[model samples]
Target: MTEPAGRPPAFRIADLIVAEGPEGAERILIAGLTVTVSAGEIVAVLADDTGSAAALIQVLAGRRRAQYGAIDAGGAGRSRRIRPSLPAGVSVVAAHERCPDGPAHVVVVDATGTRPAESGAKPAHAAARRGGAVLLVTTDAEVAASADRTVHLNRAPRPERRPKAAVRFTTQALREAAAGSLTAAGVDAERAALVARVLVDADVRGHFSHGVGLLPMYLDRLRQGGIDPTAEPEWSQEEGSVVRLDARGGFGQVAADLAAERCAERAARTGLAAVAVRGNNHVGMLAAYREHFVRHGVVGLVLNVSGPSVAAPGAGRPTLGNDAVCMVVPRAGGSPLVVDFATGTVASGKIRHAAHRGERVPANWLVDREGRPTTDPEELDRGGAVPVFGGYKGLGVAVITEVLAGILAGGTVSPLVHKQRAEPERAMDCSQLFLALSPDAFGNPPVEELLDVLSGAVAAGYPQGPPEVHLPEQQERLAETMAAEHGVPVPASVVEQLGWGAVRTAPATAGGTA
Candidate 1:
């Protein structure tokens, strides 16, 4: 095809390396880079940081000179302009969602930043419309598929930076602080203590994503009256082995605990029992509630719908909740076999914390609204979604839980709780299902014997890896024991956030199994 009148050929660069080679070079910024973008074609560049991205953009726009190699910027004349920002006629959408007016010579879509600040701006399409080239500057896993080509720079890896020192709190002091804050936030004395215990336990279990990181929002919910601190769950309905509980929008941990206790009692009599919980709040981890039944030598299963922050595989949008499932069975000679997991491809909390720490996520775990793989955790808030775990199988599990826990319990489901998030004063309006089964009911053989053989088989094939082959609760119990001896550490920032001052370095004897 003939070039348009007065339009220069597509911009091209080759054998490029940006460094301080002209003088006292401290370090190399980019190395062995090559890029080519035809007029009316878009190309994406994935880099580690915005500063390096900006530096490359300046070189391409003829604002700065590269230490090595060549750049043919189409017909754009060269200049030594030190523009702190990108050159004119080049659009750059950074953390702020603002977009430039018309298409320019080049466009850079900054996909790294806080999630809430990113709006889905189709940079490639926008550039294509103006018969221009787009250079997507991002660390995100993918640029738009419309890219004519991608240029990956081969820079020497930087030294790993040490994380800043953190404030630490003993297990006892942290729990007390959490309880006090929840109490101040209007939770009943007993309920506040229970919630604190659940949250603190999550930290000890090394599940920081589900730990006290949730306290601020919980407190806000209390302030908004979305939560009834003194709310008492009632047994709304009961059959021989089936029970329904009304949490009245109270803390979900309290509701789950109640359900566990009741389900255990009913299973003891009937040999099998189930409980449905409605109008609950954040229940922390289902493993906690499942332990209640495992302690009683009853097999246990618990299921709950989480925040609708995940997307179904091929849903083209964020549609699925972070549903969770947990099952535990008692063993006579060993810790109970426990399995627990969320249906989201990855825990959303990990994404949240990664975004907080300015870290990238695994690409396979997330997809942008355009169904492009994304490592930017920020995309989760920008109309992107975490893919369902196990693909359609994970979605199937989520649907089943919604029916068994949501619909069966006569609580919220469907569009009601589909996109809803739990607030302090606002009810999650979700439901939870708990099932307990006693082996005595079925004249079952000794499960411990079977488990012993099964465990032995697994341990026997350890291949000299990871020291010891531990079953589910085995490692957790060991971690708990160590944490018990050497108190769990709570972030000092978390302590301050909870209004706990005057840090104490004493060893703490907080809640832990004997």
Candidate 2:
């Protein structure tokens, strides 16, 4: 492997160390690279700090497992071990690739100077210039000057993972965190634990969108005076099979959980139940909420309408909300079936995440200066909008969501909400609707039997095209199995952004057969 001309040869060797549960293994992969990093040398990663990257860095550093690949850092008994802390003189900076408003500076890690302060910028810049090594992560055009060296880390060629034990612990930790959030907010003992369990379930099911990644949002909102942890959702009756709720600015997860459970309970009594909820903030993972009904042998449908950020189909002008829809169906075996997708080609938060990681997005997913197709995420902050998929068809569905969840639920529409938006917290007054149905309630026959018959028919009547039709949520369910066996495969951007190290522990053969 080619080594950068700074560190000793012993520091540069080809190897791979994948993290695992209980313990990890190593392998000597001729394909892996061991670059020599040194003091005052800048190492830049040209990608976002997404989950995939986060997990990879952990694996590479021997903190996590490797499904395949190994590391050999130097002369050692087993190359699978990590020092837990980096050696002296190494510093990590998530520049996010965008131009710094002024000189580069040390952002104080404390609450008082938390984000950035004007006075600290000069000192931070001077320190870097004085030969303190700085690791800057950013997209292509965002860097104002040449880096000492730049390393490009891209997304995994395909979705992948590591050990079963490590995966379980990670999932369990997330569940405990979720439970802690509720308990701290004064949720009852039993309810808080249940809520935490579902949150962890979301992570194990490979639904990172609603996983531990959302903890900061909860903590931030609570710390920033945006959400009320003590608040509760008060229920009110709407039309037949429909209910209305006021979440009173409480935790979005709590509101969603309550709404979904209530809808499922109603559906068990009646043939169907629909509930609309308003005044809540970010509902962690809709899949977790929907799964509540699915576990009870009920089919659940939910549509979430959020603040204005999406553009009108074909027009490129901001109009409707970036509407999202989620559905869950009970399955007898394996993981439960659930489907969740944003109507926009991509969510705005994802764009913000890309900006934070100093990465560029695919050109197709964004709009240009004149509201044409462009990949730069910065435009989004300056009145640019993300286009809707499937043209008018998708826009039509978003419109339906607005009427059902926003208007009917007594929440502000996109335009009005966007007009009054002063801060990020204020931008989230959107609404959501949950529809639950007990298959057995509608008919005397059991729900699982019908689902099985329908599932078999869907499998038998496959499309001639490449994509197969198993139920709507079956594909994700199967992916869950693999993810459970290994750990969640994080994006490469996440790993490099974290500035950790890795090694190769498994033997030099696949399947540990060496």
Candidate 3:
């Protein structure tokens, strides 16, 4: 399509992190990059990582998830996050090669770092005059330099890998090892097994941060009686399509599992059900609960609030929990579409892992006590906080979780949930919200066909990575298979945390006897 002649489209691009790739293998496509285009200007975004640049363009133009900015009370800037599914009529301009084509509110100019700057800059200039913004996403510095305004997205370089052999254990042995650790920590038979399964399940699914690595945290909390070892969940409300549960300071997973069970049962009957949970310890990962409903042929949403460890935009304090959210929907013949993430740019566990390994964290992930950005993981221990992902975008999601899971569940929100200088204590009053819905509740159309179509459309794009889309559920399935077939690889760090005390901290693959 030729460039249109009119005034530029009024749009502002801020630091956003809506980009997604293969699980665990994801890298920063764009760092804290912000670009703003006024009434008659063309902004060229240049980044070393083209993947991030393209993803950013798609998300802004409503090609990806439709939410932008922080989860503040009023509304985050310029963007909005949609739950479950994108609205009808929502379409992403399909990209050809690395360039996008077709009609869109914003037009893209794909100039591959080659050619004289004037060749492509002329049309973009013409488009802006016609009241349409031309987004030139290029790696060519010259092309970027010629735009009316140029934004340099300082994307962090991918973390360098220190190759070490993986340490493997039979799936059965891995389960036992995890369960044994909990049991040794004084957890009862059933309880230990339940928690162990979740931890191992996370590792099995490649979410090591939420997996066995958290065992020490659980043990510490339970040992100190910070979490009541035998506490039981009691239903506080069981009204139609809505319920509330008090966890009684017990293991977070137990209450979460119960909530998922009850919600799925109620949703099947009522078509929609919600359960507000309060007074539980840390729930490892919400994915376990969300996927449960998917197995029951429904959609599930889990929002959890914990200690305030996330910094909000414009706030001088770390007043928000990295509050987590997970959503799962059946993909018909394939894996469930499990979307799970915390509001933080990176999980706190990862920072701890970096500290343990003497590795530098990505700059955007941490801010020290002085409120300055840092790459040192040790800053976390010295009173640093995980920054909200994409600034306002992440805070907005955290706010949603804060309201639904904390306040609505009768628990404390952010600033109140955590004290700045207080010593670490087991968070016993954290809250969670579980919502489940029958697919038929909306339109009752053929879900299998709908998903198949969507899945096919994604496949048509030939996205990178194994199994293409890398749906969380799909990743979990693959992880489970690998665990069963090749055994689970327990990191040396995890082994050390398990009280083994002297295991080497390098990766070495090992397996139980055949």
Candidate 4:
């Protein structure tokens, strides 16, 4: 039986070959045996010899490498060999061994000499009943008959091609298209333009995860009532140098803009001001909000909290969100110094992007539901979580972010915040904290002198001259400059999904790599 319409195969082995003996004199035991197993289906591989079946099983278990071909398990990208440890959701059961106790999505059973095939077939069927696929390698005729489908070892098939290249669009064209798409989805024209600007700005700075790639998600949220485009951020409370704003489930970009503006205005009078925003949705990128402070000539510090996607140290499950922190300092005679990052090893969006492109990620970036290190990007959707960047130190920063953005702002935290992508119909109810400090309050300290001293320290530290020591925001500025001259490149899949294919331009050679 075939899998459900929109579902991908549980595992697929294409053009796989098993060989034995010396280098050139090696003999092909199993030549290009292709097998595709759908979820909840039992597939039997009928091999000519016991050695061939054993070899194939070894390859599947990651104990031996295949001579050729690719394996894709659980839609995690194709690879020539499985990692030292098998991919997530896959398990191997040896002949005469009982099936493992836990829940595995795919089970590979070696039943080469099982009698009557009833014992082997029974366990395979049981595994399928639990919503898992079973691959039974056996020469027994009964075993082949019991399977949902059978593959012969002699059949060889071709491998599929990789994903297509990204489509390119000029910055103006992409911003216009993104704004139009948002406006069509019920966002006000002004808000749509603002949102578009923030997203495109992130893209030009080489932050694709927060760039135009989020337009589709924002549009979805607009349609589902997760984001209230018509609502405006309003000051809810005020004190000497502290204020609170309620977004009322409005777009995060709008909330962030208003908060930054208010903070800067209040700081001008009070020397330092803090603004807390509650009931906001996903803020594209914190750096984008720094522009408001930059224009107002104030130093800015921003923090935001979201639903949990990062695991705390020594914990198996996610205990905190991969919250973000950003600070921007306007220099006297140069570009602003901006530092922005998530507390986790990587942002959750990076893994999501990898999954969208059918690519694998580094094992250290994520842990499966059982807390096992995995390279499968899809594991994020299966209860996996990203770990803190530098272990305990990063965890400390993340906790501080939660306290400032969630607790102090009186907004929903971790388990309380609805997932933006998973539950688009519901509001995220995340929070943000914005702080503005005026250098004029301190009689205008010599910021340029401080920067020069830092540069000099870098030179002195490395007698041979530091290997291109980069100041904060230096790389981002260079990327943005190049993107302005050339065009922004977006994934073809994303453009097609957003119906902006018509705006695509020729690929550009300049600009930061994606």
Candidate 5:
């Protein structure tokens, strides 16, 4: 490949040697592999297996050192050791992962057999369009044919066998098991049942990260006195349309439920109401609170602030919580329109879930301690931080959430809040805000009709002849229906941690008990 007049080639690898196995008896996986990728070029390296593709990409990513080679990524000098402090310009995307945002000198993709070549090539082309060099490692001939250049590598070892399928449990049985576990951990039976319902609801809706997978963490906090199971949320201060509730470092689910109920009731009488909750622990999912307002025939908005996990723009360390935002609008006879999400690219729980499942994440989801993009799920816990979604726009959402949930609620802010998992013995002191608006207050303008017209207009604007467009929460609602008819699939690893051994022996039924 030719280099630009004044700039170096995007990346140049010469005499690269990758080996595995014992030191002296090492097996030569890749020998004398040389390739050059120029800026605005798409180069494909066809290999036999994903294992080989990943090994070479790892060397390029500076995760592993090549046995013998000289790699100059960008205009940087050639070096065998690519230190962590090296300039940030190279990004690695595994199969099925989305193309990362931001400028990159080189984008390496390991697309061996995990996804179709066409799908993998789309991102490579996108990177090239952005004036970045693309190094695609694939096992498919179609992918090689689509690239600007193709390099072939010899066969490498295959990956290990995949893990067993997750165990399935009936919704009722799973809820019972969760409640029982919570009760055993010293939470009162009534509170345990309430918390279990919230968790199982999340699981059935396909939000596994906030589902019963968190029961173990909750149990630990309860046992360690970080969460007071016996404490009840009470109105600490009250006004006409506004109130403050003290969670007293209790279960966040319980506190949020109470706040939602109170807020809805007050809104019904006053047209609008807001409830601020202080001294709260970790709330599983904001969706659970939406149901209360929906049932009360009102619009609901919920905001929550947790411990810091997201970093500010250009900052290497975390400065704010990922923070959650939820909005629910009651539709006359249909399911409520629910929109729920974290302000970060992804929630912190997602990283934890991926780490627990021994999986890598998309590169854009997190940054290492030095602010370089990473795909490692474990990095979030090691001084790594998640970036705000959509850059500065999402940061604005997080800032507003913190102001309302933390400052306005008179509760601990992100920096002062305790880590839920790492410091389970201390109070998290998180905060939540529940706002309810009575639709009837404004004569209940034809909301259902307006929503229908809006949906139709959106579909009409689509180029593909009125494509099926699902409303927010529609996919989750469908998942909930499917789970009710079939069963909730819980990872075997999570089931083991919950100590529900008998579930494996239960008789199989239509709901997939066993």
Candidate 6:
């Protein structure tokens, strides 16, 4: 790679996080870095530590601003840190890693449930077992052989004399490149760009799902003639409470966001508003849609439907959908109580994450090819099912999501089947429903006042120190503050995975700007 002229001298900057050695010891390091792939190209960085894998995702997604040089991020700008609440389980992995092994699960279970004593069953059994498509993570090889395209990311030593600034692509540039790549593979440009944007933004939000992890899937769909590029949302207002959208089976997030925003507007006027979107693709992160309602001070609820990708209760077959539900309520001084989660015990992405590192998942979390309990991640990976969270309860939520989000919006998924059609980007015909309610619509109460009441009660009920009870998104704010003042703690595994080592001292610079 040619170093750009007139750029400032490059210094090694910490980019990735690494978890190394046995027992997963963690560390953070900043190593010299360079992008070897060409623009519009896809590369997979094979490394240890899923966090670093996720961080590399941030670099690719255009979320992290290039600290050293300019990089293209499609047409979108760097994600604005709104200082909103992080999702409920956002920091669970980090906490789990740090928690004492003896009583960690019990304490977490006690705090997370509806009631302190409501530990109905182990969380492994508490998750809903529904059927639907799940996003998975795998090694570069698996992605390359099974997936459509794989971009290889390998560590490269930086030159002793670094360029002043590294050239980067903008979101628009990435969109154009992705669209062209899809088009070259016979996919439509406009639709491809929409999909690219959603996937990229996921990376920006630090979510592996719906991010670069999906590039291979997108390419596969393109190769299979699955997506129609010129597709757009077909909009129509059914009634005062209903807004119907047909995404023409294009991009899921774009359609879902549009529908959610419309619902928020309608809800603001009326007490309740509902928007149903059909023929859309795999909309990544239902939480993103919830964020819209939270920002508008509207209580938001969302349901997304998928087919037999999830496991059902008592039944061995994947009967229920990986139906996901999201709820976001307004809050004061922190992010809204953002609740985003899948009904299943674990997301397929996490399973893929473990698989990528050649790790074994917890025994209870898996089932055999015949759908019995097992610790083999591969069984689940290769065509297996995960039991519902708590037999009937989890299945119940799964049913609810399917009905409200799928059937209500006129989408169907019975037996899970991967189809090749020039329609949406995922699942046969997925649908999403957004419902929003403004606090004022109910009784004309001040949002802040109401927030104060709810938050105060919750806080007073559980004082600090004894497993301090925090409202949703509260802990994330604390985590963010710690990160801002001290810096986001990068595990050692993550550092090596990104091929960037952490630096604690400033190096003497060449004839570069101060």
The clash numbers for all candidates, in the given order, read 7, 47, 26, 0, 0, 64
* Candidate 3 lDDT over residue span 1-514, tens digit each: 2222453334444444443443323444444454545444567767666665566555544556522231111112443233323223122222322534221122343222122223245656665565444556666677677677666665445654453444676655666777887777777889888887777677777676677777776777766667677888999888866799999888888888999988887887789999998877777877866556866788888888777777877443466777888888876666777888888877777777666555566656777786655666788777788878766776777778788888887567755553212423555577888988897788787877777787677666654633633344666777767666666676666576676543222223433321
Give the Å error, residue 120, model 4. 42
Order candidates by lDDT, high to low: 5, 4, 1, 3, 2, 6
In model 1, the worst 10-residue window by lDDT is 110-119
lDDT of 6 by residue, 353-413 (tens): 4454444555445555665544445676566766666668888877777778877765564
Clashes of 1: 7
Cα lDDT over the full model 5: 0.75
Ordered list by TM-score, greatest first: 5, 4, 1, 3, 2, 6
Across residues 1-514, which tens digit of lDDT does each residue of candidate 4 receive?
5434654578777656566653312456666566777677788877666667667767776777765566667653543433443455555654432224411112463232122323366778877766676788775666677888877665434442256677767777778888999988877899999999999888888787788888888888888888888988888897767899998898888988988888987887778999999988888889998767777788999998888889987566877888999998887556788999988778888777666565556655677797755656789889999887777998889889989988998556766788898899988999999999998898988876887898778668876766542456766877777676667767777887898867746356744322
Candidate 2 lDDT over 65-172, as tens digits, reads 443222332212233223543333232222221245533212111111122223233333443454444333334424413555655444344442321211123344
What is the lDDT, from 0 to 100, of the residue 409 in candidate 5?
Answer: 80
Q: Better model by lDDT, 2 or 3?
A: 3
Residue 58 of model 2, lDDT score: 46
Please report the candidate that would top TM-score against the real structure: 5
- Which stretch of 10 consecutive residues in model 2 shows the poorest summed lDDT? 22-31
lDDT of 2: 0.54
Give model 6's clash tally. 64
- Estimated TM-score per prediction? 0.66, 0.56, 0.64, 0.68, 0.73, 0.55
Report lDDT per candidate. 0.65, 0.54, 0.64, 0.75, 0.75, 0.49
Residue 430 accuracy (lDDT) in model 1: 70
